[model samples]
Target: MSRIGKKPVSVPAGVTASVDGQTVKAKGPKGELSFVVNDEVLVKMEEGSIKVDPRDDSKDARSKWGMSRTMIVNILLGVKDGFEKRLEISGVGYRAAMQGKNLQLALGFSHDVLYPIPDGIQITVPRPTEIVITGIDKQQVGQVAAEIREYRGPEPYKGKGVKYAGEKIVRKEGKKK
Candidate 1:
């Protein structure tokens, strides 16, 4: 029994949702998004809410049931309010700035790192040390942030680099003289 799959996802006001076969589509003020549920899960629109059920009483079906439901819910919310992630840069001469639609990062590298911005996603540098990523698609927003952080991951010794806001880096002691 999947506890999460048992509950239906309600279509909130101002957002429209539809389930056609295995494909679930949602449109809202933010934007429009769609998701294809797994074949092991049965998706349907019941009344004003979306319902998900396992195709069979097998372990695979049960495992995919909750996940399918969550995917539908995430898309719905994403199209309505969108998603955002914040990153902070810390290091000597380390900073970030927006070059037109692209992101320019100075993470102590020999040369500046230029990240080309993707469609439907916005990268903004509110301050030299703060980077904000926003988009209607949750996955894209997170992936873009991760790609930017990959350029210069925070080092444990100095905790200097690009990292998620509020992320704690475990410090390591240097060699004793």
Candidate 2:
């Protein structure tokens, strides 16, 4: 009954995919990734695509059906094309740079914040105010971006902080005279 689950996830060229019981693994030009589907959902490789369905008509099974399908799609795309997230720093003395393999951030703090880069992920500082995060796993890329932004979130009054590219900040009125 899940609309998304009904559609088969096609295998793209230059990528190889396989299903082993509840686990789906994909290897592509970008890298290799795998996901273990919930038992409530059934996964199988059919023809040139992957299909997901609920094992039963229960609510739990139906709830996991679409999510399982989407997870499979993400892994396939991740291994093939990877993912990217960009962050922008805005402040009087705020900036970012790559020190060896660590990301050193100066967010108007007393001392610089050093974030150790995780394996399978790359962080680049093209400019002092711009940070680019790239990785094969979509979740990891997003998590790293969020963690970086948490260091100095944008303030509504001055809008000075680290934020995702294209993000809009809601401003508040200043003190009345």
Candidate 3:
């Protein structure tokens, strides 16, 4: 028995849910998303709620049951509230700006880097040094943010680079004179 699987996901207002065979589709103010229920797990729509059930107690069923439940819940939340990731530029000359449909970043490099924003994802620069990524798909939002930060990872000395907001960087001591 999976505790998470047993819980019913509440359908938010303005969100619609439908089930067809092993597939579940959810549409909300943000957008629409579809997911295939695991073979060992069963999903059903019941009175404004989505329920997940494990077929059996076999090892495989137990393993997939929790995952399927989590996926369904995330889908519901994503369609309704969406997700967001915040990034901060810490270098002296590093900055970010939105140009047309692309993000222009200056990370102390010789040349500026341009990253095209994909459909359904919004990148906003609240400040020259701050980046805000928003999207319905949590995974994609995180991936884009991580890739941007990788262009200039935080340095241990001055902690200069692009990093997640509120992230802590441990400073390394300089060599003795």
Better of 1 and 2 by TM-score: 2
Residue 53 accuracy (lDDT) in model 1: 98
User: How many clashes does the backbone of model 1 have?
Assistant: 0
Q: lDDT of each prediction vs. the true structure?
A: 0.93, 0.95, 0.89
Of 1 and 3, the candidate ahead on TM-score is 1
Instruction: For model 2, name the residue pairs that clash.
Output: none
- Candidate 1 residues 1-177, lDDT tens each? 989999999998889998888999999999999999989899989889999999899999999999998888889999889899999999999999988877999988799998999999988888999999999998899999999999999999999999999999999998899
Give the TM-score (vs. native) of candidate 3. Answer: 0.92
Q: How do all the candidates rank in terms of lDDT, highest first? A: 2, 1, 3
Instruction: Give one digit per residue, the lDDT tens place, for model 2 in 14-105.
Output: 99999999999999999999999999999999998999999999999999999998989999999989999999999999999999989999
Q: List the residue pairs that clash in candidate 3.
A: none
How much is the lDDT of residue 161 in candidate 3?
Answer: 96
TM-score order of candidates, top first = 2, 1, 3
**4-60 in candidate 3: lDDT tens per residue?**
777888887888988888898989989999899878888888888888888877989
- Name the better of 1 and 2 by lDDT: 2
